[model samples]
Target chain A: MKIGVIGGGQLGRMLALAGTPLGMDFAFLDPAPDACAAALGEHIRADYGDQDHLRQLADEVDLVTFEFESVPAETVAFLSRFVPVYPSAEALRIARDRWFEKSMFKDLGIPTPAFADIQSQADLDAAVAAIGLPAVLKTRTLGYDGKGQKVLRSAADAADAFAELGSVPCLLEGFVPFTGEVSLIAVRARDGETRFYPLVHNTHESGILRLSVASDAHPLQALAEDYAGRVLDQLQYVGVLAFEFFEVDGGLKANEIAPRVHNSGHWTIEGARCSQFENHLRAVAGLPLGATTRRGETAMLNFIGTVPPVEKVVALADCHLHHYGKAFKDGRKVGHATLLCADRATLDQRIADVQALIDA
Target chain B: MKIGVIGGGQLGRMLALAGTPLGMDFAFLDPAPDACAAALGEHIRADYGDQDHLRQLADEVDLVTFEFESVPAETVAFLSRFVPVYPSAEALRIARDRWFEKSMFKDLGIPTPAFADIQSQADLDAAVAAIGLPAVLKTRTLGYDGKGQKVLRSAADAADAFAELGSVPCLLEGFVPFTGEVSLIAVRARDGETRFYPLVHNTHESGILRLSVASDAHPLQALAEDYAGRVLDQLQYVGVLAFEFFEVDGGLKANEIAPRVHNSGHWTIEGARCSQFENHLRAVAGLPLGATTRRGETAMLNFIGTVPPVEKVVALADCHLHHYGKAFKDGRKVGHATLLCADRATLDQRIADVQALIDA
Candidate 1:
């Protein structure tokens, strides 16, 4: 089966890597000439919103899926007319905007921080008054990797926050004094069969994911699965979904949902019995979902900005390096390392060893 | 780094799949217009012995390697002038012909069935008289998958065997009344660091591999490693090598050596901490070899001739399908399935289930 991916980034590269062994081919549509995934498959170097390219991609592939949620909803809708797009246009529409995502979470009884749509300065002020200080003001759309968002700790910060964010449609969400952050990665097949990877403990630096360690028998696994199930069933989702949560008061609050395979689940490539990429392809291809069982004590460390030398990384025992074949740039995600160890002590040590390498 | 491969069959396809994640690129040189691995990287359609194409491949890649022993020695020698070729031309020379291979094994004190080179009809008669009945006559080169050979059960069988084998140089060998067949896959790095995966028990039908199950704590692992170590060190070999043996009287007799990745090691992709393909690329790329620790009870079943529907194979739990994307033909290896389980019972059951699917 040939899959049309809307974004030719590292996620798409990995999806191709996982799907290729299953006799699945890929064609990626990305505007960038040097899109990292172009080497793996056909690269349709056209904008996501280019209707001609979208039609061309839909014409060639059996089904279409997007690597990132930011793919314009109209693009999904346009392609959906020709081919089936997983995580549907409606899922993309709801996920691309924080307001709809949080509202859906709220409606489904999935806990979320106090949030209100803000369309004007007065709306921000009113939201701040109702939701209190120490809130976050975020653009309802086009926000990722901590961009297009601001933290409002006080009224002074909130004064220019609305204007600073280009005064666009926004959302004001009350801050959660969370003890930790976690994410649940789940896949639902077209037949409604769902499988969830264990919740992963995530550490964010500058609002970007830095590390994620797969949890084993976490106390909140059942609750996290229940919440993700509600969202999947509600959307009739058919692909991998990443649900981020802020752990507070021994519970999880929905942070956001990425309607595609996610970075937090990168460890699944080697750490799980079947990777999230393969599961996503399986679900999208109308095949049975694979086992999401964890293989070992696994942790994934993102290589932000630049990656360590390949030799140094491969020299480490039990370490798997995934370089995105992209040029190094400041604040860019060039690659990641996955560590699968027999015990937590070794995993922690390997993680620290890799962390030191990245820092150096 | 970019590497050039000589054959674009399933092995090359798998090598590309394994190396892509390491930020490595591939360009395959194969005459086949529809080589299965062509999708993974650049394909230079040319014969292996084509000087212009071989020079072109050598000029573009950091190093070169071949996936099969049948690659002509002159091709390896030609590529070696411009770029380093792993396993060396000499390794290929010795492995491509059965006489040289068995002679090397015998010289290393590695046990083998009695053998003699047959140059004429008298030579075959003399060898049959010396080696006794139930011997096999085989072409010295360009033979694979039970082709170019015939079994001699008696003098009448031996009378026409040499004439029937195209009057080419051949070898007559005493048949081993063995209980089982096994292969040891080992990798050697540039620094001479060597790692060996546990022995794999292989089953053959009509002289073609049908199944391979990785052995855990096999009684003869150390002995097999010792014998294979001799060959690796003797040749100063770099990259993955498979040494097949016939189990006899609770011991092993060297059968043949494939100076490249072997089919029996396919289970390492999921059953081992690091796979043979990755290790071979690492060794050739001057990187560190990965750990070869087996993950769980693992077995691989070859989908000979044709594969069952993808949905049927993937529907089984813990089954990883690797379809080669080749047109199915009788006696062809179209694909294979690797089953990983926590226990021997589960592995056995899954193996039977897959076997049933293939049969049905």
Candidate 2:
């Protein structure tokens, strides 16, 4: 089947990589003249909101899906008129904006950190007075990888925070002292069959995801799946969804949701029975979901800015390198490596070795 | 690294599928406009012997390799002068002809069926008289999937066999009353590092491979590896090679060697720690070879003529579908399904289910 992807980044590249073996073709829409994924499929070098390009892509492919949730909902709505779009415009509309996502979680009885919509300085001040200090002030939309957000650590810090955030519609969220951060990647088919990959423990450095380790049996597994299930069913979501959470004092709090294939689940490419990229394609293509069982002790390391030497990575045992074929730039995600080890000790050792290489 | 592959068939398609994840680009040389692998890489729509196209490919790629040994030795010899070519022209020359292959096996102390060269009707008669009735008369070059040859069960069957085979150079071989057929796929790096996949028990019908099951510990695995090692070393080969054998009287008689990745090794895509395609690329690209350990109870089912419905094949547990994206034709291999199960019984059950679907 011909699939139209709304973004031509690593995720779309990976989607094409996984789907190509299953006899699926892809067309990606991205403004970059050399979007990394353009190599894998037909690249429509156009903006997401380009009506002519959207129409052309819709006419060419059987369905449409985006690699990132930041795609404007109107773009998806426009494409939906010409071709089926997975995960729905409603899901993207809700997930792209922080307030809508947190409100939806609250509406669905999923516990979330206390949050309030901030339209002005008065609203921000009121939210801070009510929710107390040490809150995060974030733009309502267009934020990712910790961008467009600021920590209000003191009353003085909140003085110009609203104005500092471009005086835009925003969300003021009470910060949780979380012991750990985790994400659950779930895929719901068109027929409503849903499967959840094991909850992944994620670590971030400077607000960018650095590592993710798949859990075989995390204590919060059921809770994470339950939370993700609620979101999936609430939106009638079709295709992969990633929901992040903060582990609180023996409980979980919803952080956010991404309405697309995510980085944390990258380990599934080598560490699971079927990769998240393949499952996302299967789900979006109206095919049965593949098995989500974890294959071994697995962890994924993201290569920020620069990918380490290829020979060093491939020479390591049980390590699979996935280079995105993008030019190096500071803070850019150039590639990643998935290590599938036989045991936790081995995984730890390999992770350290890879970490050392990345650091070097 | 950029790779130039001659013969844009399913094998080239698979090689691209495996290599794409490793940040490699591909260009395929084939005369067919709709070559199955063309979708995966840049397709040079020209014959293998087209010098201008070969030179263009050699100029573009870091190294060159062919998916099939039938690529004329002269074509490889010509390309090698411009760019590095894996497996060398000498390797291709010996492998593309049955006479050279068998003679090499004999020289390497690898067991083989009694064989003799045939150039004319008199030569055919002498070979038949010496090798006895029930022997097979096969063209020495350009034969595959049970094509280009005929089995001579008696003197009557040998009447016009030479003329019938286009009077090409031929080999008459005494048929082996073997218990089964098996193939060992091995990869040799430029530095002489070699790794062998476990022996695969294969079954064929009408000379087309129907099924292959990976043996975790076949008794003759070492023997097969030893014979393949000799061939690899003899050729100073780089990249993947397959050595087919007849399991006769608890021993292996070399049937032939393919200088490229073989169909029998398809199971390694999902069943082995690293796929043969990826290892072949690693070898040709001068990168480190990946681990060759088996993942689980694995077997591959070839979809000859037509692929079973994708929905049905994928619905089965642990069944990974690999469609070649080729138009179906009688006796053509259009797709395959790899069944990876946790145990032998489960694999057997899954294989039967997939077989039933194919049979349907």
Candidate 3:
């Protein structure tokens, strides 16, 4: 089957790579002819919002999906007229805006931090007063990797935060003081069968994800799966979805939903029974969902900005390095290294081994 | 670095897939535009024997490799003037002809079956007298998967056997009373580092590979590694290589050397720390070799001729199905399914599960 991916990025490249072994073909749609997915399949150089090009892609592929949520809902709806879009246009519409996504989580009885929509400077002030100090002001749309968001640590910070965002529609979320952050990599089939990978503990540096360690020790592992299951059922979601959460006090609080394969789940490629990319293809292809069994204690380290020297990384016995073919720039996710081991202790050692190399 | 592959079959397709994550690009040189690897990367529609096309490809890519040994050695030697041909044109020259390969193995002090080159009917008669009944007659070149070889059960079968092969340049071999067949998948790097994956016990049906199970229990496992290491050192080979061997009485006899990834090693996709394809790419790209550590007890079942229903194989928790997207024909390797388990018992059960599926 031919699949049309609306964005040409590392995610699309990975999905294309995963699809090849299954005899599935991919066509990447992007304005950048040098997009990484171009290395894997046919890259159609056109704007994502170009209706003519989108329709042309729809005409060629059996189904359509996107690697990024920033794609305009109108463009997705337009393509849906020609072919089925997995995860639905509705999911994309909700996920595109922070306000709508958080509201949906609240309505579904899923746990999320207290949040209020801010439309203007006055609204932002009112929201800060209600949510209290140390809140986060974020643009309602197009925010990722901690961009387009500002933390209001003091009342003085809130006044400049609204001006900083240029009066865009936004959200003021009450910060949840948490023990640690975790995410659930879940896939919901078209048949409504939902599967969850083991909970992954994630660490961030300067608001960018640095490491992800798959663990069964999260106190809310069962609760996280339950929360993800309810969300999947509520949205009638069909495809790989990731739900980020914060461990606040003794419970889990929803952080956000990524309705696609995520970075934290990258370890699945080497440490699970089936990779998230492959399973995502299987689900999108209408194939039966495979089991989500972790192969071992797994940890993944992002090779941000610069890839570590190969000699250092290769010395680790069970580590698998994946370098996404992209020009290296500061803070860019150019690649990743996944370490699979028999136990957490060994995995931790491997993590230290890689960390030392990165430091060097 | 860019690499040019001469064939666009599964081997080439896999090489392209492995090369992409390493920031290496590939151009497949094939006459058929729709070859499988064509979808994976840049594909140049050119005949392998065309000197102009071969030179263009050599000038375009950093290195050149062939997915199959059937390519004429003269074509490879011509390309080598402009680009490095890995495994060397000499390796292909030796491996393509049965008599040359067997003679080289014997001269190198490697154990091979007792055999003699046969170019005429008189030579065949002499070979029968020396090797006796139950011997095999095979073409000197261009044969695989039980093709181009016939067994002589009695003296009466010899005269017609010569006619059956169209009386091409051939070899007659005395069949060894072997207990089992095993293979070693090894990679020799440009830096002269050689790594070997664990020996895999293989079973064939109707001359087609039916099953492969990795075993550390094979008595000749170390011997196989030592033998393969010597071959790699002697050839100064670079890239993934495989050696097929027969376990006879108490020792191993070398059968053949495939200077590329072998089908029996497909289990490495899920059963080893680094897959043979990835290792081959690393070797050719001059990157450090990856770990050859086996993940666990593993088995691979070839999906020849047809793909069994997914339900039949999906029950095994760790079973991975790889469908190569080729049009199926009688005795064709359309795809394979690999099952990774914690122990031998689990692997046996998984194999039984797949066997039941094929039986059904």
Candidate 4:
């Protein structure tokens, strides 16, 4: 099968890596002349909205999927006319914008933090009045990795928020004072069958994800999957979907959704029966869902900006390194490492060793 | 590091697949215009002995290795003048010729079948007299997967053997009345660190391998590893090596060695902590030897001449399909599937199901 990917980043690179062994061919579309994934398969160096290239890709491949959530929904809708697109243009439309995603969650009866749409300074004031202080003010669309969002801690913060955020359509969400953050990678086949990976605890540094550790028996797993199932059913999703949630006072509250392969599930490459990348391909290709059994305790460390010396990483026992072949720039995720551990103690020790190497 | 490969067959394809995640680049040289692995790396379509192409490959890559044992030792020797090649020309020379390989085994105090050199019909007769009847006559070099050998069961069969085999440097081996056949995959790093995968029980039909099952606690494992260690030490071998053995009344007798990845070790792709392909790359790249711990019971089924429907194979739990992307012929190995089972009962059931599909 020939698969057309809409973004040529590490996620697309990994998707190709997983799909090649299954006898699937890939072609990727990205704006970068040297998208890192170009090495793995055909790279069409064209803008996502470039009609000629989009038509060329759609004409060549059996189907289309995107790695980047920010890929404009209209682009997917346009290509869907020529080729089937997974997760659907509607899913992208909802997922790319915060206001729509939260509204969808509320309509589906999924638990989420109190939120209100903000269209003007008066609307912002009303939102602050209704959602209260210490809320998150975010642009309605195109925000990721903690970008395009600010915290309104008080009245003074809210007064300057609209000017700071450029008076754009936005959302005011009451912050969930949580004990931890968790995310679920859920896969749904075209036949409506769904499977969720074990919930993972995520840690962030300076608003960027730094680590994710899978907890198969986390107390909130059932609640997390329940919340994710509603979103999947409402979206009628047909591929991998990542739903982030906050563990507030031991209860789950929906944070957001990413309609594509995600970083939290990267550990599955070495720690599960089927990797998230492979599962996503399997789902999008109309194949049976693979087993999602976790192999053991696994922790994934995201390498932002630079890939550490290969020797330091591979030398560690039970650790698998994935270098995405991306050009290094500050705050860009260039690679990741997944460590397999037999128990919590070993997991802790190896995590510390890898952390030391990354720090050095 | 950039790697130069001498043959772009399935083994080379797998090596590239395994190495790419390590951030290594590959260039392959093969005579076939449609060498399928070419799609995965830099492909230089040329004969293995083409010095110009070999020079170009050596000049461009950090190290060179060959997947096919039939790659001429002289080619490796010539390239060594420009860049390092693993499993040195000396190793290739010994491994390619049955006579020299057997001699090396004997010199290293390793047990092998009783054998003698055959020069002519007269020499064939003499070999029968010396090694006794029911012997096998095989060419000294460039033989694989049931090719280039003839078995003699009686005195009358001996008269036509030389005529059948034609004028060639050959050997007459008194066949061991063995109970079973097994092989070991061993690795030696540049630093002389050596590790061996557990001995695997192999079953062959018409000299082409049909199945390989890892027998972790096989009684002769120690004996097999010990025999393999002798060969590695004597040759100072680097990279992965295959040592096939014949089980005779609960003991082991050496058969032959392949100085590259072996089909019998394909199960390691999913069943070992470190795959043989990864270990081969690590050894050739001058890295530490990876842990060779077998993950669980693994059985690999070779898909000779045809690949069944992907759905049919993958439906079985823990089965991994590796399609080689080769053009199929009557006896060509197009791909393989590895089955990971938890116990004897589950293994048998899964094996029966997969075998039924293969037989179908």
Candidate 5:
């Protein structure tokens, strides 16, 4: 099958890699000609907003999917007229806007942080009054990797936060003091059969995902799976989806949903029976989903800004390092390393070994 | 680094895939425009015998390697002027001819079955007389997967066997009663460091490899490793190499040497710390060779002509299937499935499951 990907970033590159073994051809479309996915497939250098390019891409491929949420919903909707877009334009629309996504979650009886839309200064004040201090004020759209958001510690911080965000529509969400953050990577087949990978406990540094370790220790692992299943069913999602959540007071609260395979699930490439990208392809290609069983306890550490020292990293026998063919940039995800081990203790030691190399 | 591959079959396709994560770029030269590796990299369609094309390929890449030994020695030597070819033209020349290969093994103190080269009918008669009855006659060159070889029960069968192979240079060898056959997949770095994966006991039917399972029961496992190391060092080879050997009377006798990665090592995709393809890329790209530790007891079954039933294969839980994108032809290698398990018993059951699916 010829699959068209709307963005040509690392995720698209990896998706293309996964498609190769399955004999799936791919065309990656991006505004930049040098986008990473170009290395893996035929890359079309055209803006997502270019109707001609979208039409050409839609005409060429059997189906289309997006690499990121910021891809215009109208583009996806228009392309849907010519080719099937997995997760649908509706999923993109909801996921792009924080308020719409949270409201959808609440409507579906899924737990989410209490949130209120704020359009004006008066509305912002009212939201703060209702949700209280220390709430997060985020732009309604185009936010990722902790961008387009600010934490309002007090009434004094609210005005500055609003000013920083400028005229963009926003949402105020009451803070959930969670013990940990975890993400569920799941895929729903065309037949509505859903498969869930083990939940990954994510740790972030400087607002970027630093590490994610797959765990069965989450109190809401079962509940998270059920919630992801319901979400995919409601959306009729036909590819990999990641739902990020916070474990607060022994209950899970939805944070956000990524409509495609996610960074937190990168460990699956080495640690799962079938990788998330491969499973996503299987779902979209109408093939039966392969096993999601974890091969062992695994951890994935993001190589942001710089590649860790190779000598030390390679010395750790179990670590599998994947370097995305990308030039280094500050805070940019250049690559990741996954370590697979028999248990948590071995994984922890491997992680420490990798971290020591990175620090050096 | 930029690496050039001289062929674009499944082996080159896999090498391209393995090179991606290592930050290596590849250029493939092949006469087949639609060769599988072409989809994965910069493929230049040119006849192997064209000197201009060979020189252009050599000028464009840092190093050149052939996916198959059938590549002419002249092409390798010509390219060596501009770019290094791993395993070297000398290795290819020796390995390509059965007579030269056996003589070289003997000179290197490697054990082999009694053999003699046959150039004409008189030479054939003499070889048969010297080797005795129940022997095999094979072409000295261009033979693989049962092609260009025949077995003789007695002197009465000699004319027919000779006629079957046609008027070609041939070799005659006395048959030995062997308990089993095994192969060692080993890699030699340019810096001369060598690493060996565990010896795999291989089972063949109709001269085509059917299955390979790792075995500790083979007394020659250690000897195979040592022999492989010595052979690679003698050849000064740099790349993954497979050596086929026979077990008879509790001793291992050298059967043949494949200068490139072999089919028996396909299980490394899921059954080893790093796959043979990946390690091959690493060695050719001047990167550190990865650990060759086995993940678990593993078995690989080749999918010849038709794909095995997916449902039955998937039921084996940890079995991973890899289907090469190729037109199905009788006795052609279309793909393979690998099963990884905790022990031999589980692997035996998995193998049975795979065989049943193939039989069905």
Candidate 6:
């Protein structure tokens, strides 16, 4: 089988790595000629909107999937006309627009932060009056890793929010005060059979995920799965769907959803029964779903911007290092390390050791 | 760091997969341009004895290692003059010849089947008389997976055995009436740090490895490790070395050794804390040795000659499939499957399911 990935990043690179062992080939369409995953398989360097390249990819592969939700939904729709695309272009269309995503959450009776679409300054002011202070203003589409979003702490902050956001189409969402943030990765086959990995607690610094630890038996696991199940059923989704939620008063409030494989789930490569990458490929390739049971205590640390000394990382016991073979740049995710420990105590100690090294 | 490999086979393919995540680059020297591993990294399509290509590879890599023992020791010796090579050319020199390997085993007080060298038909007759009836004759070098060897069941069978082996220099050895076979994979670092994976019980059909199960607390574990430790110390090995032994009356008898990664150790990919491939790369790259604790009960099944339907294999729970991407041919190793289970019963059940598929 040949899989065509729409974005060539770490996730695509990992997908190729996982799929190759299953006797699957890959072709990636990306705008950057030097995308980190280009070395792994066929990489067609062209803009996501390049109809010619998208057509070429669709013509070559048996099916199509994407690494990130930022790829234009229209491109997916264009490819879907010629070949099968997993998770459906409708999933992409909804995930890219925060308004569509949040509205769908409300329509399905799933709890989410209060929000309203903002088309202009007047709309922003009206939303603030109804939703109250400390709300967040975000562009409805093409935003990720904390980009294209602004926080309104008070009425004074609301006046300039629209101007600061380049006056683009956006949405104003109420602040979700919670104790923690957890995300669940759920995979659905075409047959509608669904499964989920355990909820993983995530930590972010300046909008980029820096740490994620698999939380076995977290009190909110069932609630998170319930919310995710509602979304997957609503979309009749096929492939891995990641949903992030805020823990408010011991209940989950849906935050956002990514219609692709997620960074927070990377620990599955070595820490779970079946890796998310392989499972995603399985779903899109029409293979039976794999078990999602957690193996043991595990934690994943993202190596943003720069990779640490190879010898030091390799020296850490039970630590597995992954470098993306990417050029170093500030705030870029160059690599990550996954640690497998026998118990929570050992997992904590190993995470601390890695944390100290990264902080230094 | 860049590592150069001496052969391009499944072992080398796996080594590259393990090394890529460690930020290491690779360049392989093999005679086949269509080597299965060619897609993984730089492929130098040239004969093993091509000094110019060998020199180019040595110049590009920070260190050198190999995937198979059939690679000539002199080729390794020649490359050593340009770059550092692991397992030492001396280790390969002794391992490639049956007479030298048996002598060294005897010198180290390791028990092996009684054997004698045959120079001619007269030598074969005299050796059979000395070693006893029901003996086996094999070439001194370049034989694997039941090739280039024959057996003498009795006086009537002795006449044709010499003629069957192309009249090459041979070794006549007594047959070991052992209960079973097992193999050990051990890694040693430049700093003298050593670690061992748990021994694996092996099943072979017509001398081709068919199945291997990680046997925890097997009665002969310590004896196998002790024997392997002697060889590592003697060679002062700096990478993974594999030792096969025949289980005789709950004890162990030494068989031949492989100076590189062995097929029987493929189970370690998902069965151990760190795989044998990663450990080999760590040793050659001068990194710390990883923990060898078994994850759980596991079994590996080798796919020979052809591959079964991929979807059927992927449907098996907790079963991981691997394909070498080589054109299938009779008697060729095409791939393998590793099944991880929580207990012996579950492991056996899963292995039986996969076994039925391969047998069909």
- Write model 2 residue lDDT over A75-94, tens digit each, in one string: 98899899999989999999
Q: TM-score, each model?
A: 0.99, 0.99, 0.97, 0.97, 0.96, 0.97
lDDT of 5: 0.86
Question: For model 3, which pairs clash?
Answer: none
lDDT per model vs. reference: 0.94, 0.93, 0.87, 0.89, 0.86, 0.90
After TM-score superposition, what is the CA distance of residue A343 in candidate 1 from its true location, in Å? 1.9
All candidates: CA RMSD (Å): 1.1, 1.0, 1.6, 1.6, 2.0, 1.6
**Which residue runs of candidate 4 sit more than 4 Å off their true CA positions?**
none
Candidate 1 vs candidate 3: the TM-score winner is 1
- If chain B of candidate 6 is superposed on the true chain B, what is its TM-score? 0.98
Residue B221 of candidate 1: its Cα lDDT?
A: 98
Any runs in candidate 2 off by more than 4 Å, and if so which?
Answer: none
- For model 3, the stretches where C-alpha displacement exceeds 4 angstroms are B310-316
By TM-score, how accurate is candidate 3? Answer: 0.97
Look at candidate 2 and give me any clashing residue pairs: none
Candidate 5 lDDT, tens digit per residue, B1-360? 678998888888878777777666788999996787877788889999889988889888889987888788778888898888887898899889999999988888888999999888788888888889888899999999989998988778896566668879998888988888999999988888889888898999999999998765456778888788878888888899999999988888999999898899998888999999888877775668898878888989999998765444544567877766677789998878888888888888888888888898
lDDT of 2 at B278: 94
**On lDDT, who's better, 1 or 2?**
1
Tens digit of per-residue lDDT, candidate 3, span B1-360: 788998987888877777777777888899985687888877888888888888889889999888988898889889889988887888788878999889988988889888999989899999899888899899999989999999899988898787789889999999999999999999999999999999999999978899999886566878898889888888889999899999988899999998888899999988888889889888887888987778889989998888786545554577887767777788888888898888889899889888877777
True contacts kept of each: 0.85, 0.73, 0.65, 0.53, 0.45, 0.72
Tens-digit per-residue lDDT, A166-239, candidate 5: 86899999988999999999999999999999999999987899999998656678999988888898888899
Computed on C-alphas against the true complex, the DockQ of each candidate is 0.83, 0.78, 0.63, 0.67, 0.52, 0.71
